[model samples]
Target: MKFQRIGEHGAERPIVVDGEIAYDLAPLTGDIDGDFLASGGIEATALALARKRLSPITIEGLRVGAPIARPQAVWCVGLNYAAHAKESGAPLPDAPVLFFKTPNTVIGPFDDVLIPRGSAKTDWEVELAVVIGRRARYLDSVDEAMDHIAGYTISNDVSERAFQLEQSGGQWSKGKCCETFNPLGPALVPRDELDPGNLRLRSFVNGESRQDSSTADLIFDVAYVVWHLSQYAVLEPGDVVNTGTPEGVALSGRFPYLRAGDVVELEIEGIGSIRQTCRNAG
Candidate 1:
């Protein structure tokens, strides 16, 4: 099953998308958020839909917001893909390289992504985003880590190369936390519905293909990433983890940086896709 939030930003209504029909989730929950997920919302919603307890609603002209509400934290893994690491001139890490993007950077899937003011190196990264359902602390094994995940969605990990590298003072979040830097969703596919290890995730800038790679290339797979993170920080429900991007980003100097009016589209196998227009931040 797939879940979505549709309407204006911050005012979206929760929904369950089954094939072409969208069922209202308002009767069961107010939003697709941490509280809901932590309370078996996905299971309840599925059961309700199967019993025809949910009302089918029209979503013809509604805007699609991020699948989940703003999370308490947005964690990220850097260079988990070996080719991406090589392209960026970084050595493969023996362990996960972690960072955080301020939670407010999360935005609707189809919203406009702002190119930060005085920025000339804004780049795009398409990544598989994991949404945590259960609180995870010091998880014992990779096998156990799967139990804590709720679902997966796509994330456009937009960045300003200058701010991330030249001006970051060694902290990558400086470039990652800009408003609207993270465009997530269209829908979140439940963990059982898709295999995260081999999904195809790609990015296109202005109709041209940029990053095209599968999660199979990940040096550290999904389960290990979750297990590894748990050792250092508690993973709460609704917190998002972006599992790094593949090769072919602007940071490698292979393509031109994003400019205002450029359209960026990202898609992950099984989890649907998102498109965003680029505009200069005021």
Candidate 2:
């Protein structure tokens, strides 16, 4: 089953999707957020649907917001893909390189992505986004990390190379935290329904392929990333962790930087795809 929020930004209502039909989750929960996930919302939703307690609704013309409500924090793993590291002329890291995007940077998968004003190196990265389902602090082992994950979703980690590398005195978040930089979700697939270990994730620009890689190439996989972060900071429920992107980005000099009106599409196998039109920030 897939969980989603449908309607305008800031006013979306939660719903669960099973095949062709969509069911309202309003009777069971107000929204799909940290509180809902931490309290076994997914399990309860399953049970409610099984007993025909949810009302089926049509979503033909409505907007689909981010699958999970705005997360408390959007954690990102940098240089976790060996090929991507090589493409950017960086050495393989001995440990996971971490960074963050402000939670508000997250937007609906199909929404517009604003090109930060005065930007020339806007780029695209298709990543596997993990949604935490429980509070994890100082986790004992990587094996136990899986238990805290609620589900998986797709995140288009839009970036501005110049801001990320040259302008900010070496901090990546400046380039990362622009409004609409993180386009996330058409649906959040439960962890039990999909394996995050080897899914294929890809990105395209203006109908041309830009990124094409698999999670199999991740230098630090999902479990290791979660456990590794837990050793340092507490992982709160509803926090999103972007595992990182693969090679074939504009930063590699393989393609031109994004411009206003360019369309970018990111897709992950099983989780689904998101498309965004780039527009200059007003």
Candidate 3:
């Protein structure tokens, strides 16, 4: 089942839409998560509610907001895809390469991605974001790990290569934490609705195709990634993990980085598409 946060221009609310029956979720509850993944989260409770009722609000009347209002944390994996690793000129780490992008970077779909000032190397990475449902710790197996996921969404891991490598002690966050860099949600689709291994991911700039690939190319798939990350950190509700991107980002291209006025669009087979316009900070 698919769900989204909806509303008119100024007021945004959540609604459960299963087929044609749209339920006014805001009248019943607050956010999508609570104790478990679905009971109060994006995965089940809302979906279960969506399939049953039709307390419809104007479908196109309100504005849409990020599926998850304020994510607990936005985590990212670098070089998880073989082609991406090669393009970025980094050797694939034996273990997942992790980084942090403060949750503040999270923004709604279609918002403009600001190219931070002095950012001479802004890059784009179209990644599949995994939303956690249950709080997990020391997960025993990949199968068990997979069970902890709530759903998925499309994310653009907008980056600034110069900050990452040259100015900031080689910290990934330096290049990754530019404001308006992370554009999330047209909507968050349940994991059951999407077969992760088979989905196709594509990115375009100003209508020109740049990155094109499949999750099938991920050297480390979703399940293993969750299982692996859990060994060290406690995975909490609303924590978002950006599974990583395929090749063809500007940093890895045979060209100068993004300047300004470039628009990026990313599509995943069933997860919906995300379009972001780039504007200079000046």
Task: Return the candidate ranking by lDDT, descending.
Answer: 1, 2, 3
Worst 10 residues of 2 by lDDT: 166-175
Candidate 2 TM-score, C-alpha based:
0.99
Which window of 10 residues has the lowest lDDT sum in candidate 1?
Answer: 1-10
Q: For each candidate, give its TM-score against the true structure.
A: 0.99, 0.99, 0.92
lDDT per residue for candidate 2 within 148-267, as digits (tens), equals 999999999999999999998868988999999999999999999988888998888999988888899999999999999999999999999999999999999989999999999989
Residue 165 displacement in candidate 1 (angstroms): 0.4
Taking all chains together, the TM-score of candidate 3 against the true structure is: 0.92
What is the model-wide C-alpha lDDT for candidate 3? Answer: 0.80
TM-score of 1: 0.99
Q: List the residue pairs that clash in candidate 1.
A: none
Model 2 Cα shift for residue 20 (angstroms): 1.2
lDDT of predicted model 1: 0.95
